[model samples]
Target: MKALLLVVLAALPVSAKLVSREQRLDLVRRARLRQAVDPSTMDLLNGPQGDGSFKVGEAVSCKYEEKDPLHPLGGHSPKFPCWTKSGERLKVKYKGEANPEVYGEVAGSRLLWALGFYSERMYSVKIVCENCPADPWTSTKESPRAVRTFEPATVQRRLKGTEVSEVEGEGWKFSELDHVNPAKGGATQAEADALRLLAVFMNHGDNTANQQALTCLEGDPDCKAPVMYVTDIGGVFGGKGYFTSYRHWTKKKSLWKDAGNCVADYKTTDEKSNDPEISEAGRKLLADLLGKLSEKQVRDLFLGARFDDLSKRQPPFIWPDGKSRPLTVDDWVKAFLEKRAQVASARCPR
Candidate 1:
């Protein structure tokens, strides 16, 4: 019976083509089945270690292949480029029996179910292992481990009103607004405000991966606000302290210093020291934005919570001398919402 099943499975089609970004996102969003068994029985041939484990929020390495139900076996292949719902470009990698042929068919049916739980969408490719069996296939027994690889999706340059370049001496430039103030341009003001809020949260969360130039949008020369976007947030909520805590401190120092320096550099009056390329209005706008922030707001932005929460939960990070803190994500979220409401009401005024 096993021999017959192997013969039949071997005859079945096995390979597939690369999926477009739209299709891949759709699969991740809508797919109901989070896990699938390898039909090729490669795990049996290669032993339990060969089976792949899939977990929520864990990054997977996969590759793209032409869609074909009848191809042979292999593993570890390059993937094709795709886009995310947030308009960011990404690539998908496939491992195990996740080849295009298997993935394409399964993805269409399973995607919607997957999205019901995970708010974020995902893209996936397929792979094949040559040394796998073809009958009585079982999910390989092995500890769940996510494959590690640098995702190129987050690379960004130039936002509507921002010019991001690594020019020596001149420093990062945003030429849209006058010197020191970021509010000169209406659109720039909105973008800057959004980034400021985001930066505060990121700083508190200690998200180093996002600290660099990750989420930036290009186009719209008239607007000069730096582009910021949130990519892979898996590391946001929970993780080991060694990796997460270290990153927290490292990112905090780097972002705080760079952001503060950038603000100070643009706000300075000395044209010789300031980048000549930056507009006076832009500098003024940055200064005004920074100026509007109270010391408490700055602290809150960095600490991310009310004093009450901190007393109860006691976050992992040490509070600066004489500083109050918040305890939970809920507490921080509530405070953030309240502050946003106040800012909106004050700025927009009915």
Candidate 2:
């Protein structure tokens, strides 16, 4: 079907219509933030259409692909390409030293989605290793690369002048178009403000374009405007942890506790600024979304990343000082709730 669409589009003359960067970004922001007021639509998108939330008792299976790339994060934990019994393919990683990283990624994705931000579907599925190939750990593996999240036609349209370049310094073997820095181009004021607020809220320090992808509705290349999603979100929710050098995550209420009218690190321009119109709406939307979740649902969001066999408290966390305590599901949920309150209070005052 996609091939046929491409063929049909190819026969037509190139779209002489030029879409300005601002227009494209505005379209994207609307599509993303629009989900807030539409519950029925949210359910539909969050359902099987988009990456739905993981369900309890879902059958899961795993098999190691020696050719699959290993994420640097999996150094302590192992990762494998897995499929739910329903045939949803996912990249599964075991939790060991990378426990917080996996949890943060899953939490961030869920929270952002709950708040109506476009995010890739991610969930926890326990891999039945019995069905996997022999000596999975011993098999040869390659380093991870950025997965192509956009359709071919959309990529061509959105990135006309941007050059695809190899990331120097990093030992990256793959190439992808640069699309992360919204300030460089292709970002609306609303999106810029929303993204910055989310970053501070989640302590998402990594705002590099590489961590994001401009995807479309139902993977359609010809969709009017491609929406942005954080396809790679493993680097989130690290507050004061010594090992959490990638993103800042804190259980304490600090980043946005007093977020008044401005976001740090984001510049104000005629085109983009800490606009109250966007930020105020975003705060209400996020707070309302967080209110809809139950403690159990929040707990499930965290456990969704860990192996199924582990108990709710099975993977007890140890701090850098060697003093260890189990990170309970309730405790995690409480932290989120506290943050949600702070966010609501920080919005443009009523």
Candidate 3:
């Protein structure tokens, strides 16, 4: 009976066999070590077919190839460096499990590609090897792992014009816009201009992760004046969704109304939530900045349309209860302008 059992086990397909805990632990260990050695280097290891070796400072490119039936969005792929002898670059194809989490990897890879780095392939490596004490991780012994390897020259060619310098203190950094301290004073005009554009961009993109100011400077401080640019664009519309209404309870009506007054309120709430110094500083800066813009301009910038245009259209104002009334952009703009003016007056005091 024992001999029969051994024979049956031997006949089982390799892919069908489960990996032992020790083996899993080994893989985890190797992955963690790889991450510690270089956090950016092992970005692709989370994929299914992302096995193989890579050196530090090597450029890699990857893309999603297949969708997992269960996940329909996430899966794995191999990582390819920019300068392999075979002259291969680009994630030619993806073959592995499709899961939503895998979609996140694809999203991340797309972001990196947009930022301009070149390499082919991606894999899943361990993040904390020391934390994992079970099966150790190992690359597949099969030749396919090697066959997937490609030359780095091809990656360089594809990355031509996509390279973004990853210089610290020179590129993008994050910050808050509404907070101001008495000692720090308000943001300068230039800072306010940048922050205004950034706030619109963030709102349009549905980004809420960063409520502080961020600076993206080009080049080194000693080398030359840094050109400030937007660092985080991930909050844009395609990545997330946004809402445009505020809830207010009217004492007279004893009912809730969609005030459309929430955006500024939200910003104010965010500002006051910060430390006193930072909050004061941001308030002063924003008040000064808003003072420069006409109420019409603020409406146009945030609402994506002029009050006149909205008035001409006379769009219906639909209440949350499904009742609709004729309303125009002017109506919303007038209310918003009054509220903002009140806020500015209270906060800035001319």
Candidate 4:
């Protein structure tokens, strides 16, 4: 099927009048998905593997490979693709050392992986591209020379799964749990509700329709019981503008609007947040997972994302400024524990 799609597409003229841009891209996406999938290798929680857990400061050399090559729209966050020496294709989304999203994305995925969820097999690795690109995250341009890229850049091995959502690129919604829940989509309802709570915990500000994905754990085209997973989590751990502000994040740590009825009132941009109500099971599940984190593991969450170096930036952090203050590992650990305490708080809805 993969070969046939390409063979047929290659035969068609570039000027095919009837095909829309979406149609053409969908064609390419499906073909690539089929070609790259290895059914036996499919595992939702397959990582936060050796690469994501260990490669900070030490540069992992890679050759730049242009995937999108061109960003349809220009943006600040520069994310592009590269192939490591071991031949793993990774998506690198790095802004710089000062940018909190770098830490947020890595921490979010790693935390999710730790909590036993299907998440990006992402690691924070220093990058040196042999054939570097100029703003490759949004432009197709490249440089011929080797370039040292951002520090603590998130390097995530691409995830593969059969599409289970009705819309291809536009993924499922928090409202549409039937598309990914076990009672309906095969993932536990507690998992779905816990995700909503998790989004609030992070004060997620970029929960777009396409951010979460619904897909089968298997690579089979006919795979049923698809599970939902967060495909991109870069904009977490902060509120408006996705800033890694300690004051803002810690200031509003409450997870409930009406704890007795299990209502949530944290910040979010997801319009599909209404259907799933928080349950005791969901809250407990998250709290239980968080409770399992050892002291070292809890600290690793921020250290892995390079939160310690944030205070040492050129223009050092100042007091009373949440955004400007240098958030050390200690600061993050304290905040994290407080947040965990909120999750496990005895005052939660029964």
Each candidate's TM vs. the true structure? Answer: 0.25, 0.57, 0.30, 0.74
Measured with C-alpha atoms, the lDDT of residue 308 in candidate 3 is 31
lDDT of 4 at 135: 53
TM-score of 2: 0.57
**Residue-by-residue lDDT tens digits, candidate 4, 244-336:** 656567666566677667787754566567323588887887787677777677776777767666535424334555465444667767878
Q: Candidates' lDDT values, in order?
A: 0.26, 0.42, 0.26, 0.59
Tell me the tens digit of each residue's lDDT in model 3 across 217-236.
22321211112223223222
RMSD of each: 19.4, 10.4, 19.7, 7.8
- Whichever of 2 and 4 has more TM-score, that candidate is 4
Question: For model 1, what is the C-alpha lDDT against the true structure?
Answer: 0.26
Query: lDDT of model 4 at residue 17?
Result: 18
Looking at model 4, report the run of 10 residues with the lowest lDDT sum: 7-16
Q: Is candidate 1 or candidate 2 better by lDDT?
A: 2
Q: Pick the candidate with the highest lDDT.
A: 4
Q: What is the number of backbone collisions in each predicted candidate, taken in the order shown?
A: 64, 6, 66, 6
- Give a tens-digit lDDT track for model 1, residues 164-265: 222211122122212323232223343333333322322223233222221112353222332322222222211212111222323332222233223321
Quick one: RMSD of model 2?
10.4
Worst 10 residues of 3 by lDDT: 1-10
